[model samples]
Target: MTEIKFYRVNDAYGYLSNFAPYPFEINGLIWSTSEHYFQAQKFLDKAIQEKIRRLKSPMDAALEGRNRENPLRSDWEVVKDDIMRLAVFEKFCQNPAIRRELLATGHATLIEHTKNDNYWADNGDGTGKNMLGIILMETRKRLKAE
Candidate 1:
């Protein structure tokens, strides 16, 4: 198998605008998207071993306030190092068992949702940004090529 170079997105602004990972379904509940996945794995779960310690919240004011130099940085930084260090997408894509489940029923078509859902990834036409869609598709293609 050819080596798959996973491209980690810039979380400098919360979820990376153009390269976020798509949501995958596990069990019956949907994971929503990669943002939620990162939060759950890298941010929320304390038991999960990570180089960067998880923050109390993504928008924890105290943490944000400490970084006066770059207030513009995404609140996701708390767990950013962990994600980057782990090369999360690469790990996520490599798992054949989980990948099979996600590919079988996960919603890869939709990117953007309604405004009430916070207009996430919307292209302003009710269509999702599909950022994760593009990344995952490319990953799948590369994985197949190998």
Candidate 2:
């Protein structure tokens, strides 16, 4: 499902705006802006991607432990746990208003990309980090642009 959200912050940390107290409910109804719409979309996509990469790292580590006799089976379990971890991460890191939307979507979507590589290709964060970094980066860009 395509996400639609609007953000109005006086300051990234704290600024000033004509917006009133209840911002989340603003919801493109009473007010809306396209720049915010695009930034939110980009930031959300980046955040979810980062979350997937971060979650898959431990699974990779689990598979690498050949010293453990039954590594393959252990790795499979790790893969399952990795997915749950990403869900928790996404729920915790996502905005409160969107949390329900995310949770109700795919509960067990596999990670298509990781920090290591995927489908014989290396297309990932490459640098391990949580979704915070992406949110912060996009927040900075959005704040600066406005």
lDDT of 2 at 3: 24
Instruction: For residues 1-146, write the lDDT of model 1, one tens digit per residue.
Output: 22121223442221322224334444343343344434444333233312112333333422333444432335565655444323334534645654554344334442332232322334444454434334545444545556
Candidate 2: minimum summed lDDT over ten consecutive residues — where?
13-22
- How far out, in Å, is residue 81 in model 2? 8.7
Q: How far is candidate 1 from the true structure (C-alpha RMSD, Å)?
A: 11.8
lDDT of 1 at 137: 51
lDDT of candidates 1 onward, in order: 0.38, 0.29
What overall lDDT, based on C-alpha atoms, would model 1 receive against the true structure?
0.38
lDDT of 2 by residue, 36-119 (tens): 221222222444323323332333322322223322342443353333333233322334443333333332221222344332
- Tell me each candidate's TM-score: 0.35, 0.18
Error of 2 at 24 (Å): 23
Predicted structure with the largest TM-score when compared to the true one = 1
